[model samples]
Structures are given as C-alpha cells and as structure tokens.
Target chain A: MADFFNIIFSVDFGYAVLRVTTPILFAAMGALISDKAGVINIALEGMMLISALTGVIMSALSHSAGLGLLGAVIVGALVGMVLAYFALNLKTDVILAAIAINLIAMGGTVFVLFMVGGDKGISSSLASKVLPRIDIPLIRSIPVLGPILSGHNILTYLAFLSVWVMYIFIYRTPLGLRIRAVGENADAADSVGISVRKIQYTALILSGALAGFGGAYMSMGYVSWFSKNMTAGRGFIALAAEAMGGATPHGAMFTSLLFGMFDALSNSLQTLRVPAEFIQMIPYLATVIGLVIYAANKTEQIKRIQAHQNREARKGAQEVKLL
Target chain B: MFKQKRLFELVRTVLAVLIALIVALVTILFASDEPGRALSLFLFGPLDSLRHFGNVLEMMIPLLFTGLAVSIMFSAAQFNLGAEGAFFLGGITATSVAINQSLLPVVHPVLSILAGGLTGALFCGIPALLKVKWNASELVSSLMFNYVALFLGLYLINYYMRDVDAGAMVSFKLADTSKLIRIIPKTRVHFGLILAALTVVAGYYFMYRTRWGYRIRLTGLNSSFARYSGIQTASVIILSQVLGGFIAGSGGAIEILGMYRRFSWQSLPGYGWDGIIVAILARNNPALIPVGAFFLAYLRIGADLMARSSDVQSEVVYIIQGVMIVLIAAESFLAHYRHKLVYREARKTAASGK
Candidate 1:
C-alpha cells in the first residue's frame, strides 16, 4: 500500500500517465465523434494501425514529419470512407466490416513492410523522422508543475488540446448539434433537412483523422519506430473509455486519463513482487467493471423513472374518481 | 425454390472467393519479382506431396474445433468471442492436468481434455452472464475477458508450471501417457483428426436434429418471439455459448496434446480468429464447417509453402481473407443476382396461380 501511494504521488508517475494517455486520448476522441454521429467506428484499431504504417513509411520517404502526419490522416480518412461506403451504401454489417478492415490492416502492414525491404517485426532499417517534443517555456518556471507538464512529445499536448477542441466543437457548434441529433434520432434530423448520411460521413472522416493522429503518434511521437501490433488494443481501450465517460467528450477525456493511470501503474508495478501479467490485466479488467457499473446504473435509473410514472398514473386515477 | 436458393448461395460464395483470389493475385504481382512462380506455388504447393497434404489436415484440426465453436454461438445469436482466451487457457489448463504423474493411462488424456473444456466454458460464461444480468455489451466484455484469460494463463505458466531450465516461457513436458499417439504411419496426423471429424458430425446432429437446437435457432431468429412463446431465451443463449466454449477449449487441448512435446505457446495461436473466418465462410452451419475449415487450411498451407519457396510473403493471404469475409458477410454484395432469381421464382409462382 505504501509503495502504491508513493508511486501514485510521484512526479514521474504523473508524467508517465500523460505520456500513456496520448494515443488513447486521440482514439477516444475519434470514437466519441463517430459514435455521437450514429456510426460506431469499431475500425479505429485498423485505422490507427494502417496510419501508423503509413506515417512511418511516408516520413521515411519524405524526410518530413509534417508530411508523414498528413499522409496518416489522409489514409485514415480514406479508410473511414471505405467503411462508410461499405456499411451505408453497400449495407454491410458494421461490426463485420470493421473486423475485416482490421484484419486487412494487420496483414497489409506486414505485406507492405516486406515489399519495402523492411523486416516484418520492426521498421528499424528506415531512419524515419519523429515528432518533436515540446517544453513549455512559461510552465518550466513552476516549482512542481514543471516536471509534470513540460517536455512531453508534441502530440501529447495536441491530445490534451484536442479535448478542449472537441468540447468546443461538440457543444458550441451547429455541426456538432447535427451530429448529436443524428445519433439521438436520425429520422428527426432527416426531417429537419440535415443530411444524415452526409453528417455521418463527415463525422467518420474526422474520427478517422483523429485516430490517424493517434496512430502517427504511436510510431513517430510515442516511439521512433513502427513495430508490428504496436497499438496493442489501445484502440479498443479507447472505445471503452468513451463508453465509460457516458459518451461525453469531457467524460471520455477523464476516462482516458483514468485508463492511462492504470496503464502507467501496470508498468511501474512490474518492479514489484506483483506478476506483470496480472498488472497488465488491470486496464482491460477495469473496462469490464466500468461497463457493468454503467449498465447497472442505467437500469436503476430506468426503474426509478418507471416507478415515478406509475405513481403519477395512480394519483391521476384517484383524482378522477374523487371528481 | 429451396434448391434455387442454395444454388444462389453457392454462386455468391464462389464469386466472393474469386474476387478474393484476384485481389491476392494482384498483390502478389506487385510484391514479388517472379509473380508467375509465386502464383503457381500458391495454387499447387499444398498438393505437391503427401506430407504437404498432411500439413493441410493437421492445420484443419484446430480450425474445425474453433469454427464449430463460433458457428454454434453465432447460431444462437450470441457474439461471445472469448474462444481466443478460452483456447489459450484451455491449453495451459490441460497442460497442468497432463503434467500430473498419478492418473491412469486411459483416463489421463480424457481428464485433461475435460478440464480444459470446463475451464474454457467457465471463462466464456463470464461475458454471457454479465450480458444477461446487466445488459452490458457482450462483445466488449468478452474481449476484455480474453485479455484477462491470457494474463492469467501466462501467470499460471510462469509461476506454477514454468520449466525454468528450458530457457523460455514453456511449461513442463507432459508425461508420456498423456501424450497423444500418432495415428498415421509417417505423418504427425493423430487420432485427434478423427475426433475432430466426429465432433463436427455430432455438432451437426445436435444443432440440426435436436429439439434444443430448435429453441436456439428460434431464439436467434427472434428473441422476442421466442420469449413470447415461453422459451427460456436467456438460458438458451448462455447454454449455446457455454457449449461452444467447451468445444473450442477441448480443441485447444487436442492441439497441444497432438502436436507439441510441451506447452509452448506464449501468445495467442490465432486459431480463434481463424475460426471466425471459418464460421463466416461456412455461413454458420455446423455441417459446412469442415469444408470451410479445410478450405482455410488449404489456403493457409498453400500460402506458407509459397512463402518458403518464393519471394511473396504468406501474409498476402490475409488480404484475400479480409476481402472474402467482408464480401461474403455483406448482405448487399451480389444482391441483384439473388434478387433477380427470387423475382423469377415469385413470377413463376404467380403464373401457376395455385
């Protein structure tokens, strides 16, 4: 218990949490946008993976990190478009289509890697450019906050900034209103002359772009090289985070942080007597527990609503009889 | 009418496969310096020798089990995908049981296999129970459970069953009595193949020819209707998933017993995901699972051989697999052809005016 508290309260642990939260934060934001637009983008994993590959290869070829980031975002949007085309136009099952996309990305990356004379395991041969880390000039002067807030990869700041951006976009914009309306009631949105499909497509594209950044960060910012299956189910964890956050962007942001904390804890726990596997299991296990708790609360709320309605109905009947 | 429908289904499958093959061929043409040789090797490499043929059959063993597992649960409309974890835990659990030195010879393998199956059933049951009780999403929960099972299995092997001197994460070797016998003269194909075949047949009979299966099918078709008719839909869903888990679990046990000298897998063998593809290819039919499994194994072995003999990597098959699964699963893919056929049938029936 002492060790746990000591680790949690440390500045290093705080930094690690922010570092670990980067990819999941981006992916969760993406998931939040797509889901709010009535499109469950389960292909975030595939989108992130393919973007990671594209980011590395493009960066290596162009010798420009910006171009590499652009390439990944483009690929992500294209994949999202493919998903929309198949699911909406072609009438494919969304889940199945997403699964197929994930499988393709998984294999396609290795195939492309082999084609480019790169090993299947890692992209070590390529001297790919990495995203720059930013140290805040003003924050560096702070006594305790400096260590926790400064010297993170540039993407980490963007990931945190995205939360605010997403907040503004979702809550303070007409387009966000349309997206949420479409999710809540597509027919109603359609009735109001909002093109439901068009909004969904836009949402999916933006979602893909966000996930693309996440993927790019994994390869270029989070690490210097692209490794096979490097995203390692972070995309799914992001989905869980989004769900646990009650589908609100701010909620999703906090959930992502919570998961990131668990993830960092798992890494730190590796030095302790605790089994690493068990420690690694914490985030995923938390996802399940979080989901169950969410479900139980929803059920309780529904029961309360039903009881209130029933009591109102009984009172109305008694009033009628007295009259 | 039924025959016509079946024919259309067949055509659709053929078209999907053809498209997948063309995609694979295009990939090969771009990836390989010698596309012709690579293509030829991919097509005929698996049939070049008896041993190669045995490799296909050996690959089919686990696919058969996992395929049937997915098919059974899918037919019950439960998307519980814990088979991956179930298979992993099952392998380790069976290994733990097989490591025991006191069990009778005949009962040893049986006990181990049963233990593995039960462990898998229990592991998979968590998601089902959660879904039924709390209305939680089965897909997400099952995915989480798979990771948990993976970590738990690894922990068991690392702490309780590790053979440290072996210099890897492998467990202790099984006693000779627990090791499965090779039934073929020169191949590693064991009696497990026969058991796999028998299980497929039994699964078909159980699912298609039994009353319990009727309830499951009805539940899948419309749970509300099944409930209206007094079916215990929850139990049906849970039971089918449990049974599916058992099949997949035992398959894992069979795989380790038949092939390896010790428990060797450190990560998922991917048989469970392959089973999903198999289930899709078979259209979630128990009777067709073997054919689907065989076709998948043949493709895999062919790709493996091509990778060994040519410049093309075997991962190219995954592109084909992805295309095939998406196209086949897409309800609107080739919808016009089916629509035309159904329209013709409707016209014929109207003209008969019976």
Candidate 2:
C-alpha cells in the first residue's frame, strides 16, 4: 500500500497519465463526433492501425513528422469515405462494413510492412520521425508541477486543445447543429433542407481525421516505430470512453482521463509482484462495469418518468371524480 | 418468386466472391515482385494434392462450430460476439481437465469438452443477462468481456496450469489416453469433423423444426410483435445466446483435443470473427455453414500455400475477406437487377390472378 501510494503520488505518474491519455482522448473525440452525427464508426480500430503504419512509413521516407501526419489523415479519410459509401449508399450494415475495414487494415499493414523489408511484427528498421515535445514556458518555472505540465509531445497539447475546439464546433457552429439535427432525426433534418447523407459523410471524414491523429500519435508521438497490432484495443476503449462521456467533448475528456489513470496504474503495477494479466484487464473491466451502471441509471430514470406521469394522470382522474 | 429470390442470393454470393478474387489478384499484381508465380500459386495451390485438400478440411473444423454459433445468435438477433473468448476459455478449461491423469480414460475427453461448453455458456450469459435486465447493448459489453476473459484465462494458465519445464507460458500436455484419435492415418483430420457435421445438422433441426425455434425466429424478426403475441421474447433471446456460446465453446475444445497435445494459443484464435463472416455468407442458415466454412478454409489454405511458395504475403487473404464481406453484406448491391426480376415476377402473378 505504501509503495502504491508512492507510485500514484509521484509527478512522474501524472505525466504518465497525460501521455497515455493522448491516444484515447483523440479516439474518444473522433467517436463522439461520428456517433453524434448518427454513425457509430466501430472501424476506428482498423483506421488507427492503418494510420499508425502509414504515419511510420511516411515519416521514415520524408523525415518529416508533419508530412507523416498529413498522410495518415488522408488515408483515414479515404477509409471513412469507403465506409460511408457502403453504409449510406449501398445500404450495407455499418457494423459489418467497419469489421471488414478493420480486418483489411490489420492484414494490409503486415503485408506492406513485409514488402518494405521490415519485420512483420516491428518496423524498427525505419528511422521514423517523432513529434517534437514542448516545454511550457510559464509552467516550467514551478517546482513540483513543472515536470508534470511540461515536456509532453506537441500532439498531447493538441489533443487537450481539441476538446475546447470540439466544444465550440459542436455547440456554436451551424454545421455542428445540422449534424446533431440529422443524428436526432434524419427525416426531420432533410425536411428542413439539410442533406443528411452529406452531413454524415462530412462527420465521418472529420471523425476519421481525429482518429488518424490518435493512430499517428501511437507511432510518431508515443514511439518512433510501428508494430503490428500495436493499438491493442485502444480504439474500443476510446469508444467506451465516448459512450461513458455521453458523446460530449468535455465528458469524453474526463472519461478518457479516468481510463488513462487505470492504464497508468496498470503500467505501474507491472513492476510489482502482481501478475500482469490482471492489471491489464483493469481498463476493460472498468468499461463493462461503468456501462452497466450507466444503463441501470438510465433504466431507473425512465421508470421514474413513467411513475410521475402515472401520478399526474391519477390526480386528474380524482379531480374529475370530485366534479 | 421464391425460386427467383434464391437465385438472386446465389448470384450475389458468386458476384461478391468474383469481385473479391479480382481485387485480391490486382493487389498481388501491384505488391508482388514475382506476380506471375504468386498469382498462379494463390489460385491453384490449395487444390495441388490430397494433402492440401486435407489441410482445408482440417482448417474447416473450428470454423464450422463458430459459424453455427454465430448463425444461431444472429438468427435470435442477439449479436453476442463473445464467442472468441468462449473459444479460448473453453480450450483452457478443457485443458485443465485433460491434464489430470487420474480421470477415467474413456470419459475424460467427453467431460472436458462438456466443461468447456458450460464455461462458454456462462461467459456468454453475462451479456445476455445485462441486456435482459438493463437493456445494455450486447455488442459493446460482449466485446469488453472478451478482453476480461482473455486476462482471466491467462492468469488461470500462468498461476495454476503453468508447466515450467515446458516452454515458457506453456501448459502441461494432456494425458495420451484423453486425446482424441485422428480419424485419418496421415492427416490431422480427426473424429471432431464428424462431430462438427453432426452439430450443423442438429443446429438446423433445432432452429427449424422445434417450437422454440419458431419462437426464436419470431423474436428475431419482430421482438415487439413476439412479445405482444405472448412469446416470452426475453427468455428466447437469452436461451439462444446461451446455446450459441455452448456450441462455440465445444468447438474450441474439440479443435484442441483433436489437434494440439497442449493448450498452446497465446491469444484469441480469431475463429470467432471468421464465424461471423461464414454466418453472413451462409445467410445465417446452419445447413449452409459447412459450405461457407469450407470455402473460407480453402481460401485461407490457398493463401498460406502461396505465401510459402512465392513472394505473396498471406495477409492478402484479409483484403479478399474484407472486400467480400462488405460486398456480400451489402443487401442492395444488385438492387437494379433484383427489382427488375421482382417486377417481372409480380406482373406474371398479377396476370395469373386476372
């Protein structure tokens, strides 16, 4: 217990939480946007895996992290477009299509990795460029907080900033309103002159780009090399976080931080005598528990609403009886 | 009209397969340095010999079970994808039973297989219970449970079943008498194939001939209507998922017993996901699952052979699988032709009525 406290209370642990949260934060944001726009992009896992490979390969070739990011985003958007075409136009089941995309990404990445003369499991031969870390100017002067707040990958700050940006975009922008409108009721949105399909396509493309950043960060910001299946269900965790946050940017940030804390704890626990598998199971178990609680609360709230309506109806019946 | 609809389904399946093949070939043409050699091997490798044919048959065993499992769940509208975890856990649990040398020789494998199926049913029942009680989405919950099951399974193996003398992370090998005897002399083909075939027939009969099966179909097609019609939709849904889980779990046990001497899998074997694809291609019909499974196994073995003999990567099969699933699942891909055919049939029916 003392060792646990020491690990949790340290400044290094704080930094680890922030660092680990970056990928999940980006994915949750992406999931939030697409889910709000009426499409649940379960293909986020595949998108992230593909982009991780793309970002590594591009960075290796061009020696520019920026170019690598651009390539990843483009590839992600192309995948999103494919999903939209199949689901919206061809009338395919969205979930099935996403699964296919994921399978393709998983296999395609390995195929390309081998073709590029790299190990199927790891892309260590490539000298991939990593995103630069930035030290916050004013915050670095502080003693205890400096290390925690400063010297993070630039993309980490961008991930936090995106929450604010997403807030403004979702609430203040007309396009965001249209997207929400379509999500709530597509026929209603169409009646009001908004093209539901077009809005959904746009939402998916944007969502893909956000997820691409998350993927790129896994390879370029978190590590300078790509590994096969490195995402390791982070995409699904992000979706869970999004659901936990009620598909809002602010809520997603908080939930992502919670999951990030669990992840960091898991990492810390690895040094202890505890078996690693149980620690690794923490985040996934948390998701299941959290979702169950949320669903229970929702059910309770619905029941309460029904009971109140019943009481109101009884009261009206009694008044009529008195008359 | 029913005949025409069946014809349309067949055509769509053929078209989807052809498109996937063309796309896979084109991918090879671009990626492979020795495109000619790779393409030829990929196309004809699985059919090269009897041994190759046996390889496909061996691969089909696990898929057959998982396909039937997924087909049952899909027909009941459960969408519980925990079969992956069920398969893994089933194998592990059965391994625990099999490694015990004290059990009766004849009943050891049977008991182990039963334990696996029960464990799988229990694992899959969590999501079903959640859905029944709280109305939670099974897809997400079941997916999350898979990871939990994985970690638990690993912990079980590492703590209780670890064989330190064997390779790292390996379990103790099952007793020789407990292992399933291979049916074929040279090949890995075992008595499990007969069991798998029987499972498909049993599954088909259970879903189509029984009153409970009728209720399950009704619930799947229209749960609200079924509920209104006093079908007890919740129980039907829950029961089907439990049954599906059992089928998948047994498949895992059978595969391990018939093939490996020990539980050697490090992660989910992916037969669960492949089951989904097979289920889709089979149109959720148990009778067709074997055919779909065989076709998939053929493609996979062909890809493996190509990878071994040439410059082509086996991952190319994923590209084909992904493309094929999307195209096949796209219900409206041949909408124009389907509509025209239906129109012609409807006109003829109208004339007959007149």
Candidate 3:
C-alpha cells in the first residue's frame, strides 16, 4: 500500500495519466458536441476504428503524417455524412444505423488492413509515420511540472487545447447556440427560424472529426502500429464520460482524465501479483460505476426540483384560499 | 389492406437484399483478383453440398435463439445489449454443469442447459435492475456489463476450471452424458435445431397471445400511455429483458454442447450482434425470425466457401449485412412506391363509390 501510494504520487504516473487521457478526451469532446445537438454519435467507436486504419494506410502511402491525419478526418466526416443520410434523410433509427456502422467497421478495417499489409491483425508491415512530440521551452525548464507536462506528443497537447476551443465554440458562438437550441427543443428552434436538421448535421460532422483526431492519435502517437479493434471500448467510455460530464466540454475533459487515470493504473498494475484480466477490467468497471452514480445523482436532482415545484404550487393554493 | 401492407414490406425487403448484393459484387470486384469466381461462389456455394447446407442449418440454430431473444426485448422497447455477455456466460455456466460427474445421463444435459439459461437471466438482470432502481440508461449499462461478464468469465475459466493438461485456456471436457445428440446421420447438425424451433414458436406465443406480452407491447409502443393505463411498465421492461436473456443463454449452452467437446471460447461469440440484425430484418416479429436467421446463415456459409476457394475474404459478408440492415431499417427507402400504390387504391375506391 505504501508502494502504491508512492507510485500514485509520482510525476511519472501523472504523466502516464495525461498520455492515456488524450484519445479519450478527444472522443469525449466529440460525444459532448453531438450529444449537445441532440444527436448522440454512437458511431464514435466505428469512426475511431476506421480512422485509425485510414491514418496508418494513408501515412504509409503518402509518407506524411499530416496528410494521414487529414485523410482520417475526411473519412470520419464522410462516415458521419453517411450516418446522417441514413438517420436524418432516410428515416432510419439513429442507434440502429450507428450499430450498422460499427459492424461494418469491425469487418471492413480488417479486410482493408489484410489487403494493404498482408496481415489480418496488425499493421506492422506497413511503413507508417508517427506524429512528432513537442517540448515546451518554458515548461520544460521546470522540475516536477516539466516531467509531468512537457515533451509529449503533439496530439496530446492538441487534445487538451481542444477543451478550451470547444468551450468557446459551445458557449459563445452563434452556431453553438443554435445547436443547443435545436437540442433543447427542435420544434421551438424551427419556429424561431433555426434549421434543426442542418445544425444536427454540422454537430455530427464536427463530432466525427474530433473522433478522427482521437483515432489518428491512437495509431500514430499512442502506438506506432494499427491493430484490429485498437480503439477497444474507449469510444463507449467516452459516451459515459460525456453523459457524466453533463455534456460539457471541460466537464468531459475532467471525466476523461479520471477514466484515463484508471486506465493508466490498470496498465501499470500488470506487473503486480493481480491477474492481468482483472486489472484490464478496471477502466471498464469504473465506467459502469461512474454511469450509475451519475444517473442516481441526476434522478435525485429531478426529484428535488419536482418537490420544490410542488411546494410552490401548494403555497399558491394556500394564498388563494386566504384571499 | 393488411395483405397489401405485408406484400409491400416483402417487396421492400427483396429490394434491399438485391441492392446489398449489388454492392457486395462491386466490393468483390475491387478486392478480389477473380471477381467472377468469388461472386459465383458467394451466390451458389452453399447449395452445392449437403454437408454445407447442414452447416447453414447448424449456424442458423444459435441465430434463431438470439434473434428471438432480441425480438422479445425490442418488443418491450428495451435496448439491452447484454445478450452477447449473457450468451457467453451461459456457455461458461453450462460447461461448469456439464463437467459434473454426479448427474444422471439423460437429465444431465437438460439440467446443464437450464443452469446456463438461469445464469444468463441473472447476467442481463443487473442492467435492468440498475435501470429501474437508479434510472440508468440500459443501453450504456448493458454495454458496460458485457465487458464485465467477459472478464469475469475469463477469470473463472483461468482460475477455477482450467484443465492443466489441455495446454490452452480451456475448461475440462464435457461429459458424454451432457453432450447434445446429433440429429442427422452424416452431418454435425444436432438436436438444438428442434429446441430452436420450439423456442421460435414459444416466443411467438408469448409475444402475441399472453396478457404480459400485451403489456410489453403496449409499453414499447407508447410507454407514457401504458403508464397512464395503469400497467407496470418497469416490471414489463425487466421481464422482457430477463426472458430475452434466458433465450440467449439457452442458445449459448446448446451451441457449446452441440458444437464443441470442451469450453474453449476465449472471446464473445458474435451471435448476439447477429441477433440484432436478424431482429431488424424480421421487424422484431418472432415468427419471421427463422426466415431472417436462415437468410443470414446461408449468406455466411456461402461467404465462407468463397473465402476458402477464392482470393476474396469472407468479411465481405459483413459489408453486405450492414448495407442490408441500413436499407431495410430505413423507413423511407421505398416510401414513394407504397404511397403511390395507396393513392391509386384510394382513387379506384372513390370512382367505384361515385
């Protein structure tokens, strides 16, 4: 226990938490944006998966990491558009459409990977490029803070930076207000001259692009090779985080970091006597528990508000009787 | 009028399948060196051999269970995705019971299957319980529970049931008494086919003929109205999910006993996800589940044969399944044709009345 505490307090562990949180933060931000627009992007997992493969293949073919990232973003947006076409235009259930996207991604990514790299499991044969890391000049000079914060992958910095950008976009921009208005009440938004469908489309496309960055980070920076189902359940975890965060950008960032800490701990704990499977189950288990707690709290809040409203109504009735 | 509507649905389904096949052919042309061979094999290979046809039937058995399970749950408007985990753990539970040497021969498999079904119900019940008690989203909780079931099942296999001599992460061999009997002479098709058929009938009866079933359907169609009508929607939700899990669990047990000698699954068998597709194709109708299951099984066997004989991979079938599901579930896919037919009928009726 003493050793555990020591490890938890170490700068290395803090650094590991931030490193692991990057992709999840990106995906959670994506979930947040679309969820705020009343269109939950359950296809974030599929989008991440396909984008991961696309990033690897495009980087291998073009010999440029930036181009690979761009390609991944484009494919992600296209997938989002496909989902929009099916759900919005063709009147399919959005959840069912997302499930189809997941199924397609599960098989299609492996098929393409095998065709390109002659392997069904991993892209080790492909000469893929990895995104570069950056060391902050001023921050790097600090002692403990430098080790925990500086000299990380560029995507990691961008993932953190995106929180601020999302905050501004969601809280300040006119388009963001329109998206919120559409989400709050589509009929009312339409009455007020807002095109709910167009706002939702924009939200979903932006959501997919954020998930694309997460996928590129996975294949390019988090690790150097793309593997089958490499995104694992992070996209789902991001959904839980987004919900727990109340669908806010900064809140999602914090929840993502919390889940990422558990993930980093799981990875670090593998050297201990505990079984690897149990350790690996930690992040997923934490997600379920977190969801339950969040739900319970939400229910309690609703009950309190209802109680207050009832009390106010009784007071109004009593004043009427007195009059 | 009902007949016409059914015919329209049938036509739409046929159109969706045709479009999916065309898309699959285009994909094969791009991916396969010999597109002609791949396409031919994919379209006709399952019909070429009796054994292959038996394989299709064998595959359909598990699908039938899952499809019916999903149908029941979706009927109650529950989106519990825990069927996969339930199916997986059901197999584990059955394996545990099947390896016991104390039970009688004929009664052993029955008991084992029941045990598996019970385990599956409990597995899926957690999410339902949480949703009712804490207002959690069943969809998210069930998805999370699947991973929990997977890891817990793995731990049980590794620590409690590991056969050291097997040299792999597998449980002990199931006793001969617990093994399901093969129904056909030359094929591996087992008695699970009969059980699956029975389940389909029972599923249909439970959904359409029972008061509880009525409540479930009403809740699914309009929960607010169901609540106002004094139906216990919460219990209905839980009941439907538990029943679905029971069917899925039984399917897992039947699959393990009929197909394998030992409990050797290291990953979640994807039958549960396939169940979702089957349910969608059948429009959540229990009676049509067999048709959907058979269609999927035939396509899968044909794809497998194509992969074996040609350069094209079998994963192409997933692309077809995805496309088919999207097209079939899209309400507006053939809406214009249906509308035109309805308008013509209305005009004819007006003219006759005049």
Candidate 4:
C-alpha cells in the first residue's frame, strides 16, 4: 500500500498519465463533436485502427512523420465521408454503418499489414518514424511539476491544445451554434435554411480527423510501431468519456484524464504482485461505472425538471380558477 | 402484393451480395499474386470435399445461435451488444460445470449447458437492468460490459480452473460425461447442430407466436405506441435482451463442448459481431436466421480454404461481410427499382379489378 502511494506520487506516473491520455483525449473530443452534430460517429474505433496502420505505413515509406500524419487524417476523413454517404444519402442506419466500418477496418488492416509488412500481427519489419518529443525549456528547469509536464511527445501537447481549440470551435463559433441547432431539432434547423446533412458531414469529417490524430499518435508516438487492434477499446472509452462529459470538449478532457489515470495505474501496477489481467480490467470497469452514474444523474435532472413543470402548471390552473 | 415486396427484397439482397463479391474480387486482384486461383478457391473450395462441407456445418451452429440472439434483441429495438460478453462468460461457466467429476453420465452436458445459459442470462441482465432503471444506453453499457466479462472470466480460469501442466492458458480437460456426442462419422460435427436447429425453431415460435413476442414487436416498431398501449415497454426491453443473451450463451457452451477437448478461448470469440451480420441478412426474422448463418458459415469456410490454398488472406471475408451489410441495411440502396416495381404492381392490380 505504501509503495502504491509512492508510485502514484512519483513524477513518472504523472507523465505516464499525460502520455496515455493523449489518444483518448483526442478520440473523446472527436466523439463529442459528432455527438453534438446529432450523428454520433461510432466508427471512431475503426477510423482510428485504419489511421494507425496508415500512419505507420506512410511514415515508413515517406520517411516523414508529417506526411504520415497527413495521410492518416486524409484516410480518416475519407472513411467518415463514406460513412456519411451511406448513412445520410443511402439512408442506412448510422450505427449499423459504423459497425460495418469497424468490421472492415478490423479485417482490412490485417490484410494490408500482411501485404506490406510481411507479418500478420505487427509492423516490426517496417521502419516507421516516430513523432518528435518536445521539451518546454522553462518548465524543464522547475522541480516536480517540470518533470511531470515537460519533455513529452509533441502529440501529447497537441492533445491538450485541441481541448481549447475544440472548446472555442464548439461553444464560441457560428458553425458550432448551427451544429447545436441541427442536433437539437433538425426540422427547425432545416426550416431556417440550415442543411442538416451538410453539417453532419462536416462534423463527421472533423471527428474522423481528430480520431486520426489519436491513431497516428498511437503508432508513431506512443509505441513506435503498429499492431493489430492496438487502439483496442480506447475509442469506446472515449465515447463513454464524451457522454460523461455531457458532450463538451473540456468536460471530455477531464473525464479522459480520469480514465488515463486508471490506465497509467494499471500499467504501473503490472510491476507489482497484482494479476495483470485484473489490473487491465480497471479502465474498462471504470468506464461502465462512469456511464451508469452519468445516466442516473441525467435521469434525476429530467425528473426534477418534470416535477417543477407540473408545479408551475398547477399554479397557473389555480390562478385561473381564482380569477 | 406482399409477394411482390418480398421479391424485391430478395432481388436487393442478391444484388448486394453480387456487389460485395465484386468488391472482394477487386481486393483479391490487388493483394493476391494469382487472383484467378484465389477467386476460384474462395468461390468453390468449401464444396470440394465432405470434410470442408462439414466445417461449414460445424461453423454454422454458433452463428445460428448468435443470429437468433441478435434477431430477438433487435426485434425489440434493444441494441444490446453484450451477446459477445455473454457468449464468453457462458463458455467459462459451462467449462466450470463440465469439469465437475460427480455429475451423472447423460445429464451432465445438459446441466452444464443450462448452467452456462443461465450464466449468460445473468451476464446480459446487468446492462438491461441499467438501461431500465437509469435510462442508460444499452449499446454503450453492453460494450463496456464485454471487457469486464472478458477479464473476469480470465481471472476465474486463471485462478480456479487453470491446468498448469497443459502447457498453456487452458482449463482442464472436460469430464467425459460432459463432452457432447459426435453426430457425424468422419467430421467433428456433433449434436450441437441438432440443438441449434431446435433453438431456431423455438426462437421463431417465441418471437412470432407468443403475447410477449407481440409486445416486443410492438415496442420495437414504436416504443411510444407500445407504452401508450400499456405494454410495460421497459420490462419488454429487458426481457428481449435477456432472452438474446440466453441463446448466445447456450451457443457458446455448445461450441465449446462439441468442438474442443478443453476450454481454451483466450479472447472474445467474435461470434456476437458475426451475429449482427447474420441478423441483418435475415432481416431480423428468427425463421430466416439459419439461412443467414449458413451463408456466413459457407463464406467463412471458403475464405479459410482460399487462405490455405492461395496467397490471399482470409480477412477478405470481413470486407465482403462489411460491404454486404452496408448495402443490405441501406434503405435507399435500390429505391428507384423498388418504387418502379410497386408502381407497376399497383397499376396491374387496378386493371385486374376493373
């Protein structure tokens, strides 16, 4: 127990938290955007998986991390557009379309990997380039905080920076308001000349791009190589975080940090006497618990609002009777 | 008129399959050194021998169970994805029961299967309970629960059932009494196929003939209307999900006992996701689930054969599955043709009446 606390308080753990949180934060923000636009992109998992491999292959081939990132984002956005075309234009169920996308990504990645890497599981043979890490000069000189916050992967900083960008984009922009309007009531938005389909398309594309960054960070920054299903359940966990955060960027970042803490702890605990499988279960278990709590709170708030409305209606009736 | 509609649906499904196969051919051409050989093997390999055909039948059993499970759950509009978890947990539970040395001869497998099924029901019941009581999204909750089930099952197997001398992370050999009897002489096809068929018939009866089924159908069609009609839509939702889980669980147990000598699954078996494909292909009809399952099993076996015989990977089957699903589920895929047929049929009906 004392050792556990020691590990938790160490600068390494804090840095690990930030490191692990990068992909999830990006994914949650992506989920938040599409969710706010009323077309939840459940294909974030598949998109991330596809982009992760794309980043590895492109970076290996081009010898440029930036080009790889660009390729990943482009592929991700293209996938989003395909999903949009199927869901919006062909009138397919969005969830089912997302499921199909996931299946394709699962199989397609392995197929392509074997074709390119000559291996079925991992891209060890490919010489993929890793994204550069940045050191904050001033922060690096500081004490405990410096070690925890400075000298991280560039994508880690971008993951944190994106929260602010998403906040401004979602809450303070005209396009954001239009997305909210479309989400709140598509018919009302349509009547006012807002094209719901176009908004959803834009949102899904942006969402996929964000997830693409997460995927690239996974293969290029976090591990330096691509593996089968390496994104694992992070995309789903991001969806849960987005939900718990009430579909807001900042809220999602915080919830993502919380999940990241559990993830880091799970990683650290593997060195101890704990069963690795049980420790690995913590993040996923937390997600389910977090979702239930969020749902309960939402239901409670709705009931309270309904009760207040009933009281106001009775008061209005009483006033009419008196008159 | 109904027949016309059914005909159009069949046509659309056939067209979707053709398009999906074309996609597969293109993918093979790009990936395989010998595309023609790969394509021929993928199209005809499963029919080449009795053993390969038997593999298809063996694969069909689990798919049938999951397809029926998904069909029931989707029919009630409950998108519970816990069938995957339930299936995994059910296998574990059945293994736990099957390894028991004290069970009677004939009744052991039956008891193990029933226990496994009940375990699945309880496993899936968590998300349903959450959705009913707290208005949680069953889809998200079930997805999370799948991992929970996975880790918990692993822990159980590791601590309680691990056979250290077996040289891998597998459970002890199941008791002889608990092993399902082989039904075929030359193949691994066991009594599970019969069980699967009975399950399909039972599932069809339960979904189409019962009052509960009617309620579930109504709720799925329109929950608001079902609620207005006092159908207790919440319980109906939970009931449908639980039933689906039960069927999925039974399928997992049967697959294990009839197929393997020991419980050796190290990850989610993915039958649940395949269930979604099967259910979609069947249009969520219980009666048609077998046909859908058989189609998927046949495709999978062909892909497996192609992978063995050619340079192309079997994962191409997933591409085919994904494309087929998208095209079939698209409401507007062949809308122009469908509209034309409906219009022509309407005109003919009017002329005939005159």
Best by TM-score: 4
lDDT at position B24, candidate 4 = 92
Which tens-of-lDDT digit does each residue in B153-239 have in candidate 1?
A: 899999999988999889898978887788877778887899999999999999899988888888988999999999999999899
Interface RMSD of each: 1.0, 1.0, 0.9, 0.8
Candidate 2 local lDDT, residue A211:
86
Judged by DockQ, which candidate is best?
A: 4
TM-scores of the models, in the order given = 0.97, 0.98, 0.98, 0.99
Order candidates by TM-score, high to low: 4, 3, 2, 1
Compare candidates 2 and 4 on lDDT and give the better one: 4
User: Where does candidate 2 stray beyond 4 Å?
Assistant: A314-323
TM-score of chain B, per candidate?
A: 0.98, 0.98, 0.98, 0.98
Report, for every candidate in turn, its global Cα lDDT versus the true structure.
0.90, 0.90, 0.91, 0.93
What DockQ score does model 3 reach against the true complex? 0.81
How many times do residue backbones clash in model 2? 0
lDDT of 2 by residue, A29-77 (tens): 9899899899999889999999999999998899999999999988888
Q: Model 4 off-target regions past 4 Å?
A: B352-354
| Full ranking by lDDT | 4, 3, 2, 1
lDDT (Cα, tens digit) per residue for candidate 1, span A160-198: 999999999988999999999999999999999999989
Over B2-97, each residue of candidate 2 has an lDDT whose tens digit, in order, gives 888999999999999999999999999988889998988888887888788888999999999999998898888887889898888989898999
